[model samples]
Target chain A: MSSAEKPLIGHLVIVGVGLIGGSVSLALKKAGVVGHVTGVGRNRDNLELAQRIGIVDAWTHDVGEAVRDADVVLLAVPMSAYASVFAAMAKTLPEHAVVTDAGSTKQSTIIAANKFLPGPERFIAAHPIAGTEKSGAGAAFAELYEKRLCVITPVGDSSATALALVMQLWEKTGSRVVTMDAAEHDDFLASVSHLPHLAAFALVNAVRRQKSEGHDPFCFAAGGFRDFTRIASSSPEMWRDIALSNRDALLGQLDAFQQELNGMREALLADDADRLLKEFSAAREAREAWLAKHGDGL
Target chain B: MSSAEKPLIGHLVIVGVGLIGGSVSLALKKAGVVGHVTGVGRNRDNLELAQRIGIVDAWTHDVGEAVRDADVVLLAVPMSAYASVFAAMAKTLPEHAVVTDAGSTKQSTIIAANKFLPGPERFIAAHPIAGTEKSGAGAAFAELYEKRLCVITPVGDSSATALALVMQLWEKTGSRVVTMDAAEHDDFLASVSHLPHLAAFALVNAVRRQKSEGHDPFCFAAGGFRDFTRIASSSPEMWRDIALSNRDALLGQLDAFQQELNGMREALLADDADRLLKEFSAAREAREAWLAKHGDGL
Candidate 1:
C-alpha cells in the first residue's frame, strides 16, 4: 500500500476484545489503518487470546494505562460495561486522542461516556452494522466490515478532525459511514435490529415451550425458521445490555409493531380475507418500493 | 460420481417454470439428478427461457403433455394455481409419475390436491427453503437447494415409493428433508416466513410514509435498515398469495408476536429497565437455546 493510501493510524487502543472489537483490530491491522493496536479487556484470557492471535501489538488490564499516549481508543464492549470503562479512564484521556466506540446503543453509550470523559467532543460513537451471531476473539475476521454500514452518532460539538478521522478509518476498513443523531439512531435501530432480535427470540421460545408440552419442538424448524431466527443465536449478555440501554426506544418500537400485528390478527379472526389481502398487498408494495431503491429487482 | 451417489433421476418434468419452479428444474438438471428435463409453464416464453438455459430438455405450454412420459412432475408454481394445474393434468399423469410441489403452505395444497387426483398417493408436498428476492425463469439457478432444507408435508397413506423418489431427488440435489404434518407446517412457516415478510413491509412503509412527510428518508436507510427489511424486497405477487393462503396460521402467529412486543412496550413505558432486560434476555436466551439445538453454533 502506498503511504498516502496506507492507514495512517498508529498507537491504537481497543477496549473489550470480543467479536466486534477483535474483528475491528484485525481489519485495522490488515488494512494498515493503524500501525499498532493495544488490546484492553477485563478478562485476562481474552486479552491473552487477542495478543496470541497476532492482532494486538500489546495489551493491558489497566484502562488508563492501555489508552495513555494512544492516538485512538475503540471501546468494543457491551453497553452495560460502558460506564465503568469510561469512568476508569475518562479523566485521563490525552488532549488529541480520538475516542470512539463499537457498541450497539449509541444514545445511552454516549450518555455513559459523557459522565466519564472530560472532553465530550473527543468522543465519536459508531455502530458497525456487521457481526455474526458469534462472539469472542475467534470470531474475528478481516473482512467483517466489508460493505457494511457503520452509523456514526454525533453528540454535541464533535471536532471535525476527530469525526473525519473516524470516518476515514471505517472507510479504509471497507465500511460506508452514515451520520445521524444519537436518539434517532437508537429509535431507528430498535425498529430494525432490536425488534427483530426480540421477535426471533419470542417465536423460538414460544415453539420451544410448546415442544416442552410433549410435541416434537425443533422438528418444525425448517429453513425459514432458521433464517428468521438466525440473529437469535447472538450473545445473550451483549443483547441484554443493548435491550436495557435502549429500553425506551425499543419498547416504543415494540408497541408500534405489536399494534399492527394485532390489527392483522383481528382481520384474520373475522375471516376478512379481503382486508388481510389488502394489508399484505400494502406491505408488499412498500417493500418493493424500498428494494427498488437498493439496486434490486423491480 | 460413485454409482450409488449418482443422481437417481433419468427424466424430470417441471410443471410451472416460474421462480422456484424454474429454479428446481435448473438445480436438479445441473446436479445430474435429471438426465432429461421437460418444462411446463402457462407462459410459453418462460418455458422457452428454461429450455434455453439448458435446464429443460423439452418445452411445452401444456402441463399434461409435459408430464405424460416424465418420471417426475415437479409442480413449481403458486399455491393458488396448484388446483387449476392439477385439474388440467390429473387424468393424463403417467402411472409412475411422482408428483411433488414447491408450495409455501402445505395443508391447503394437499387438500386441493385431493380434489383433482383420485391418486392422492402420488402427490407429495415439498418446500425448498432457498430462494432470492427475485422471481421468474430468468432467475433460475442450479444450486438453489444446496445445503438447504426441503420440507416434505405428506398426507394420509401417501405412496412410500413415490415419496422415496421425491426425497431422493431433493437429497441428490443436496437438501435435507424433514417430514411434517401439513397443518403444523403452515403454522411454523407463518411465524418463521410470513411474519418476517410482514415486518419487512411494515418497516419499509414506516420509512416510506416518513419520506412522504418530506423527510429524505433514503438518507437514513443504512445497512441495518436494508438488511432487516430485506425480506420486504421479495415479490409482491408471491407474498400476497402466501399471506392470503396461510391467513389463519399467519394471523395466530401475528397475535403471539404482538403480545411479545406489547409486553416489552409496557415495560419500557413504565421505565422498568429490569423488566425490559428480563424480556429481552428471555428472547435472547430462548433464541440462543433454539439455535444451539438447530444452528451450527454451540
Candidate 2:
C-alpha cells in the first residue's frame, strides 16, 4: 500500500465548498488525510449541509476563523471571488499554512493571490480535473478526484513548501498531480477548456437560431447533441470571466482551429471524401489512444 | 400501466443486428415486447452472440431468410451499407411488414431507399437518441433506448398501417419519438451531430499541428481536454459520410456559429467585457432551462 492508502493526519480548511470544493472536502476527509476539514462559504445553508454531511468537521462564514492554524487551506470559490477571499483571510493565516485553489484559470488567480495574501510564497494555484454538470455543496461527492489530474501552477515567487503540501493533499485524494508554470498552464487550458466552451456556446446559439428560423427539418438530434453542448450550460459568469481573462490565448487557439475547419470546409466543398475520411480516421485514432492511456479513475 | 410495461406479442425481425439492431433485439426480448426476435447479420460471430445472449430466438446470415413472416424489419448497419442490404431483402420482404432504420442521415436514405425497395410506402426512417461512446453487438443493451427519443422521418409517401406498426414498435421499446421531414431532419442533425464531430476533429488537429510546430504540450493534457475532445474518437467512416451527406446544412450551421464567434472576437478585441459577460450569461441560462426540462442526460 502507498502512503495515501494509510491513515493521514492533517488539519485542512476548504473555502467555498461547492461541487469541486465540497467534493475535495469529502474525498480528503474520507481518506483520512485531513484530521478535521473545515468549510467556509457565504451561504449558511451550504455550511450547514457540509457540516451535516461531515465533509467538514466544522463550518464557518469567517475566512480568518476558517484558516487559523490550518495545515492546508483550499480556495474552491470562483476565480472572481478569490482576491477578496484571500484578502479576508491573509491576516489570520498561520505562517506555515499552505494555500491553494481548485480554480480553472491559474495565472490571474496567482497574480491576484500574490497581491492579497500576506505571504506570496504560501499560495499555490491548482486546477483539479474532476467536475460534474452539477454545482453547490449539495452536489459535492467523496470520490470526485479519483483517477483525475490535478495541475499545480507554481508562481515565480511561490514557496516550495506550499507547493509540496498542496501536491500532497491532491495525492491523498487519489489524484495524479503534475506541475507547470502559471502562464503556460493558462495558455494550454485556454485551448482545452475555453475554446471548447466557446465552441459549445456557438453551437447552442446556432441551433437556437436555426430553430427560430424553422430550418431543423430532419430532427436527427439525440443524446449526442445533448452531451456535446452540455458545457454550454455552465455558469456563464464564471466562463465569461475565464474567457476575458484568457482572451488572447483562447483567440490564438480558435484561429488555429478555424484554419483546420476551413480546410475541412474546402475538402467537403470539393467532395474530397477520401481526404475527409482520412483526417477523421487520424483524429479518431489519436483520441482513442489518449483516452485509453488516461483511464485512471473512470 | 403503459403498453410498454406490458408484455409484447408477435415476432420482431431485426435486420443488420449491429449495435443498435442488437440492442433493439435485446430490449424487445427483455421487456417481453415480443415473443421472439429473429436477427439477420453478415457476421457469424454476431449471430452466435445473439443466440448465446438470448437476444434472438433465431438468426440468419441471409436477409430474405430472416424477414420470412416478419412483423418489422429494422436496418441497423452503417449508412453506407444500406443500399446493398435494402436490395438484398426488398424483394423477399413480408408484404405487410413495417420497415424502418436506425440510420443517421435521413434525406438521402429515403431517396436511395425509395429507388431500391419496391415498397417505399412501407418504410419509416428512425434515429434513436440513446447510445454510448461504444459500438458493435457486444455493446448492445436493452435499456439503451429507455427514455431516449427515437426521431422518425416520414418522407414523400407513406402507408398508415406500416407507419403505425413502426411507431408501435418504437413505443414498445420505450422511446419517446418525434416525426419531421427527411430534409429538415438532415439539417437539424448536421448542426447537432455532424458539425460537433467536425469541431472536435478540427480542435484535435489544431493541437496536433501545434505540437508538430514546437512545444511538447500533449504531455500536459488532462481529463478536461480529453473529455472536451472525446467525440474526436468516433468512427471516421461514419462521420465522413455524415459530413458529405449533410454538407450544405453543416455549412450553413457552421456559418451561423462562425458569425457569432466573430462577434465574440470583436467584443474581445474591443475589450468589451460587459457584452461578453452578457452573452455568456444568456447562453448559460438558456442551456440550464433546456437541461431542466430535458434532465441531465449530458
Candidate 3:
C-alpha cells in the first residue's frame, strides 16, 4: 500500500467517547488511517450509541482491557478523571502503544501521566482548540476538527517517535499542529478559554439573581446577551474540572480581568466619558484586528 | 384605501439614518405604511447611500428642514446626541408631528425629550431591541427587525394618539411591541444588553493587556471566546453612550456580576470543586431555561 493510504493505527482506544473523542474517531476513520476504534467510557449507553453510530468499531467499560491491545490510546475524559483513568490502564497498557490526551489543560495532564503511566515518555499531551456548547457522542461529527488548531505540548523526556506519530494523527484529522510549553498552554488557555467561560457563567448567574418581583431580566435579553452567554450552557462538570485543574493560571487571569473591569467601573462612576470611549474603542480595534487575521475559523 | 393599505405616516423624518433608522424606513416602506421617508445624518455619504438604496425617499443634512412638515420624526442617533438633536429639530418640528426615538436607554431619552421637545406630550420614547455589530446605512435591511422586541416606555404625559401611532410603526416592522416603565426598561436593559457589552469590552481589554513578551493571548482564542467577545467589536461610540446614559443601572449590574465572579474565584482558590460545579451548573440551567423560553431570537 502507498504510505498515504496505509493505516497509521492498527487499533485506537478512546478513553472517553464524548464529543471530542467521538469526533477524533470519526475523522480518523474517514481518513482511512485507523483499522479499528474502541470506545471506553463509564456510560454504557453512550458507548453503545457510539458503536451503533459507527464512531467506534467496538466498546468497552474497562480501561485496562481497552488499552491492553491498543496501538494508540487517547485519553479524552474530564481532567478530574485523568489520574484515575491513567492509573487504571497503567498496568495493562501495551509498551508499544503511544498515549495521548485531548484535555483542556496540558500541565495537569502531563503531571498525571508522569505520575501514573508506566512510561511517561510515551504520553504526548495535546489539546484540540475546538468545541461547541453541545456534548455527548451524538454531537460528534467528522468535520468538527477540520481546519482547527491542535496544540501539542511535549516534555523533555517525550519520545520523538511518539510525538511525531501524535502530530501525524492530529494532522490526519485536518488540524494544524503546533508545539507549546505545557505551562504556557495552560496560561494562554486561561486567558482565552477558561476565563471567558467563567465570565459567561458569572454573567448568567448575575442576571438570574436580578429576577425579582415578577420582573425577568432575561426577557429583555436579545442576540448580544445570547451570544455572550452561549458558553454558559456548556457542560458544567467538564468546566469545573478544567477550572480546578488550571486554578493558578485562571486565578491570575481573573485578577487581571477584575482589574480591567474595575477600571471601567471607575470611569463610569467618575463620569469619564472619554476614558470609557477610549477603552471601548481600543477593545474594538483589537478585536477587529484579531478577526482580520484569524478570520474566526472556529 | 383600505385601513391596512392606507399610509400610517405621510411624511417620515429619520434623523441619523444608520442601521436602526434606515432599517425602520425600509421596513415601513416595504409594509406600504409610509408615504415618504427623509433621511438626515451628519455623514453625507451614508445618507446618499440610504437614498440610493431606497431606504429613504430623500436625503438631507439638516434635521430641522427634514422634520419641518413630518407626520412622524424618528430620532435614531447615539444617546449622547439626543439632547442636541432634540433641540435642533424642536423649533421647526410641526406641532402635529409625533416624535419618537430608537435609542438604547429610555429614561435618558425621555429626559432629553422632556427638556428639548416643544410639545413633550407628542414625544414617544421607544427602544427597538435589534441590531448587528455592523453599522452604517449599507447594513440596513427590511427584515432587520423581524421577530424582534421593541420596547415603548411612554411618560405619563405622553399623548395617547402619539403612543398608538408609535406602537403601530414598530409593529409594521414585525416587532412585538411591549410597554414598560422607563426606569424598569433601563434597569432590565442594563442587566441584559448594557452589562454584557461592558463585560465583552472588558474581556477584550483584559486579553489585550496580557500581550507582553511576544505572547498574544488572542492567538489561542477559539469559538467560545469569539462569541463571548463579539459585542466588543461593536461601535465604541455607541456603546459608550449607552453605558453612560444607563450608568446607575449598569453599575449595579457590574457590582452584582463582580460579586458572582468573586464567589467563583473563592471557590477556585479554596479548591472547592463542589461549589464550582454547583455554581456552573446553576448558570447553565438558567441560560438553558432562558433559551427555551426565548428561542435565542434576536
Candidate 4:
C-alpha cells in the first residue's frame, strides 16, 4: 500500500458516474477517505446500478443539488457534455468546493472549466491512464486504477490545495501521479492512445470494406487482429468527442503515423527485404523492452 | 476429443521443429495418430530440446535422412528457407510420402515446392491460423491448434490423396479445416493477419520516433495501446519474411488501410464530429459482432 496521505473529504460528488466516476467512488470509499459518495447521472438505471453495487452511497439525477455540500466534485462526463455539465453545476456548487475531472484530454477540459465555473483555480484536470474496452457503471471496479499512471494538468493560476487534493485522491486509487502541461498531456496521449485508436478503427473499417462476395475476412481474423484492434470496440461516442476535442494534437499524431506507414509500404513495394526486416526488428525490440519494464499492465 | 477420424501415419517428419512444427508433432502424438515423430532442424540444441520435451520421438539434422521412410512431411521452416529446404529434400524424398507445410504464406511455399520437388501434386500447402508471441520447441503444446482455423491451398492438380491426408492431419490436431485457392488464402490473410501486424509495428515506430526529452509516451500507454500493439512484439524476422513473400497482397492491404486512415484524417481536419462518430460506431459494432461469433480465438 502507498504511504501517501489519503484525501479526507465529507462529501465527494461524482457527475456522470460511469466507469471512471464509479471507479473513483469505489476506490475512495474502500480507502475510507470520503464520508459519502453521491453519484449524479442522467440515466436512472445506471445510477441505481452504481448504488446497488456499493459504488456510491447515494444516487441522484440532480447534479447541482448533489454537489451542494460536496467538498470535492469529480466531473466524469463526456467531453461533449462538459460545457453543459459545468454550466449546470456552476450556479449551485458550494463556494469552497474543489473540482476535478477524469476527462482524457486536459486542455479542452480546463477551457470548459474556466468558461463556466466561478472557481476555475479549484478545478484540477486529471486523466488517469486506465480503462478496458468495457464501459458503464457495470464495468466499474475499485482496482481499475491500480498501478496506473495519472497525469494532473493544473493551469498557471490553479490553487495548490485543489491540485494536492486531486493528487491525493488518485494516490488512494493506487495511481502514480505526475504533473504535466495540459497541451503536453494532449500531445502525448494523442500519440500513445488517441492515434492508436484511430488506427485500429481505420484498420477494421478497411478490412470490412474489402469483404468479397464469397468470403468474410473477419472469419479468418485471429488473435493478432483481435488484440490489435481491440480498442475499436471501445465507446464510439466517447472517442468521437475525444477525437474532436483534441483535433490538432491528434492530427499531428496521424501525420506522424502516416509517415511510418508510408515508409513500410515503400519498403514492401520495392521488395526491400533488408529495410522491412530492420523496421520490424526495431519495433519488436522496442515493444519488448517496454513490456519487460512495465510487465504488460497496459 | 473430435468425433472425426484421426490421421494415421507411419513416420511423421517435421522440419524446423519450432512452435508450429512441434505443436503439430505434440498434437498428433497425443492423438496416437502417428507411429513416430522425427524432428529436423539446423539447431542441434533445438532438435534435442524437442526430443527431450517429448514433442518428437527422435531428432535429426538432415531433412532427407529424416523423411526417407516418412509417410508425411511437414515443412515448417521460415519462408526465406523454403526454397533451400525444398531443393535439399527433393533429391531424396520418397515417392509415396505426402508433403504439407505450416508456412504463413501459401503462394510462395507452393511455388518453392513446385520448382524443387518432382511431386508438386503431393504437397498440400497449409497455414494453421494459430500461434502465440512465444516461439521455439519449448513453447510447443498439444492444444495449440485446438479450435483454431487451418487454411489449406491445393493447386489445380494437387493429388486428392495428399489433400485428404493433410486435411485429416489438421482435423486430428483439433483444427477446423477449410480449403481455398492459394491466391485467395494470401489475400484473406493479408487483410486479416499481415496488415494488422504491419499496422502494430508502424504504430510502435511512430511513437518511438516522437520520443522527446522529459517524456516517454510508452509510460502513459494504457490498455488501448497495449492491446492494439501487442502483435508488435512478435517475431520480427519471421514477420519480415511473410511481408516480403506476400508483398503484392500486403501492398494492396496497405493501400486500403491508407484510404480509411485518410478518411479519418479528413473528418478530424474538417471538425466533422458526425462522420467520426459514424465511423467509430460502425467499427465498434463490427468488432463486437466478430468477437461474439469467434470468441477471440485464433
Backbone collisions counted per model: 0, 9, 0, 0
lDDT of model 3 at position A10: 88
Any runs in candidate 3 off by more than 4 Å, and if so which?
Answer: A1-11, A29-37, A48-58, A132-143, B2-8, B30-36, B52-59
Give the poorly placed runs of model 1, Cα more than 4 Å off. Answer: A1-13, A17-39, A48-58, A64-74, A90-98, A118-151, A156-179, A212-217, A259-298, B1-40, B48-76, B83-102, B110-181, B210-230, B266-298
Candidate 4 lDDT, tens digit per residue, A201-275? 998999888788887888989888888988898889989999999999999999999999999989998999889
Docking class of 2: acceptable
Candidates arranged by TM-score, highest first:
4, 3, 2, 1
Q: Which wins on lDDT, candidate 3 or candidate 4?
A: 3
lDDT of 3 by residue, A1-298 (tens): 2556658998999989999999999999898889889999989899989999999989989999889999999988888888899999999998899999999999889989999999999999999998876788999999989989899999999999999999999999999899989999899999999999999999999988889896798989988898999999888988999999999999999999999999999999999999999999999999999999886585
Per-residue lDDT for B197-231 in model 2, tens only?
A: 89889888777666634344565565556666778
CAPRI docking class of candidate 1: acceptable
Choose the strongest candidate by lDDT.
3
Candidate 2 chain B weakest ten by summed lDDT: B1-10
Reference-based TM-score, model 4 = 0.92
What TM-score fits each model?
0.72, 0.75, 0.91, 0.92
Task: List model 2 lDDT by residue over A1-298, tens digit each.
Answer: 2455634436788898888988987887676666778889889998898788777788888999888878888898877788889999988998888888888888788788878988878888898877887888899988888877788888677787777777888987788898877777777777667888887877777666676454442234555666667677777778877887777888888798788888898999998999899888877777676567654444
lDDT per residue (tens digit) for residues A1-298 in model 1:
4656644677889888888888888887887668778888878887888889977888888988887788999888777778888888876678899989987788888787677888778899998878775778878888888877788988668889899999887877788788887887787777667776776666665555445343354644544456656666665556667777898888777666666666666765676657656666676676556556753311
